[model samples]
Target: MADLVSERASEAKEITRRTALERGAGVAAVGAASALAAALSSSSAAAAVPGAKAQDTSSHSRGTTLPTVVAGVRIPDSQLTRAVTEFARKVSSESLFNHVMRTYLYGSLMFDRRGIRYDREFAFVAAVLHDLGLVKAYQTPNERFEVDGADAARNFLRGRHMPAERVEVVWDAIALHTNVGIASRKRPEIGMVSAGSGLDLTGNGLQQIPADALTEILAAFPRAGFTQDALDTILSLCRTKPMSVLMHPFAEVGRRHLSDFQVPTVEDLLLAAPFEE
Candidate 1:
């Protein structure tokens, strides 16, 4: 059956991507109490999927002085693996969460390769820290919501010797991550700017959020911080992020194995049940 073949293809593609994450997660897990480890643990909810294997435990805490965080090598944990998992779940693991993260890394790497001059640091940090606002929102009042993401990123970036300016860029990007084309006002260590939040479950590419939900998110970022151009650019990438797996036009950007399954729409997204926690 056509459906059978499509599912097989989707699964095969997913396996290829997951293998990449297993190797990378192995690298991230090498650190003791590292961002990578914390991030991986946080995604315990997503790891509930059947047959998900543990990353090789050897790499992370292998008795190192300072963990190795290189240009291409990404140690996903908090802002990273977790964020990517959230995106995959929002789409019902349509692309297999691990595979989606792998694809995202590929996209980011491609962007960097194409003289984008970006670093995986921002992308990794932004991804891990992006949804931190959600955690903050649950703990704080709605007015404190938007500030939560930025505040968390600001706090985490501090001890790492992240330059004041670059930290500022990441903070701003996190604050308005839900919006689109935010420039990382903060100086980047690897010249890679922090793209905004990867929080959209629907992938509508919104960074500023709808005016109604703006109260919590906007509490940190004033209305003036909203930038239409930045928001649009982010949306464009998020939109094109799933052409291969999502059955969309730009899916040509990657190989979307959507023969058996189609990407969820806003309607399908709404029908999904609330997470019980």
Candidate 2:
């Protein structure tokens, strides 16, 4: 018994140590990206057209048009957008961050192909932050990972003083991104977020994008072992927070990857109720 206890303690220490290292790496990457963005913003301002229409000069505006357009999709370039990107970088592993970026770009391409009108910035924000629950910084012990991510995104936007209605849209987009039928029936932005992420994870809508555009998108954000990394992250969450995965599909991940996973199934809960019926 004493040997078993010591082994468990050692395992716990290792998990904590690895988590700390991952977070440290994320922060370092964020810092480098921020410095590069600032330098590029300054250079763009210096080379601006002499008499172009004045851009929004608010704190949210970057005041320069450094080319953020990638693969015919224009990624919004503003102070607020940069902040959103930087925050994701700080909280997410590189593979996960790249996955979110691909999610946005893939969704944007689909929107363009279908001639669907939507708010680009809102969609981008929702897409990038959709997996926040999977990251250590935004995870909660009890909520479904989707809800945790949505709540985190909502709080972040509200802290920025975004309007309630707009914030709600983003919340729905993130929260329902995994709910296939329901999400697709909601507002356009919500549907796009779900569809985009679904495409990246499962190739559900690969036929919607042309081969050339897909090539370009992948080139910009290489998968970089995203599939295995994502699986490990999910399995980690399942191990640490079994309750959070109880009613969600993540329960299956726990069952498959975790030898000790014993969370009750929906049917188990239903049949085990105290009622005499």
Candidate 3:
């Protein structure tokens, strides 16, 4: 536990320092640091279960076997599923691919608990491709990583002949998964993707889930340093494309992790807006 805490603390500090140096925005750095601190605190609290010895699965145990069922439901193994799985595996590390799988499982479980009718396949697609921008193949400089990921998902589903509305839903879900408060109010598909990822990433909604259910999910899709891997992935993207993070959801995170990234604040944007005095 101490080691986990120490590792998270160091990761947070590095991200915060980089973002601060890159953007030269003290305020953004402070905000990013606070958010990371809160995430670490929430994660530590969630792990306070009885007899919890291991914080995450060891590297040796990863890829040994993945369960066929999660959260009391059998995972689908369609052609599309296989394609998406292969695409993500080719781009992401094993740990990140597992994280993506858990995102779907957790999202679907949340919908089931609410008695809501959700398109399980849609959730699966959205969650599976949610982090494409973090991979080198999908990285783009013109938009936020979320938008880039959304575009990639949109293109993939288009090739599969998915209906326009369904593809749009997946696109929106992936694009807005990082947005808090708003995603939950959108379509069920969108809401679940956002909420599920949050729960898996930071334990933000972990309290609402049954302990046994969470235990089952983790046992099936173990997190092998997912926290560090995710942070490192984000930092790497910011490093490669420092300006891309200027005004996106990860703006503050970027400002904290890169020494060369700088962007306009809301006030600056307002001053520069058209029709300004």
lDDT (C-alpha, whole model) for all candidates: 0.34, 0.64, 0.60
Q: Write model 3 residue lDDT over 1-277, tens digit each, in one string.
A: 3444344334334555544333322222212221111111111111111222223322233333345677785576677776776555544555666677777887788788779897776677788878664544555654556666677777777877889988898877877677645677898888777777777777766776888888888887678677776666666656666555554445556677766655444444444434636
Among the numbered candidates, top TM-score falls to 2
| Number of backbone collisions per candidate | 36, 0, 10
lDDT of 2 by residue, 1-109 (tens): 3444444334333445533332221222111111010111111111011222222221322323324877889999776677787666555555666678888888899
What ordering of candidates by TM-score runs from best to worst? 2, 3, 1
| Span of 10 residues, lowest total lDDT, candidate 1 | 29-38
Give the number of colliding residue pairs in candidate 2. Answer: 0
- Evaluate model 2: give its lDDT: 0.64
TM-score comparison, 1 vs 2, better candidate = 2
- Model 3 earns a TM-score of 0.71
User: What's the best-to-worst order under lDDT?
Assistant: 2, 3, 1
Model 1 root mean square deviation, Cα atoms: 19.3
| Candidates 1 and 2 compared by lDDT, better number | 2
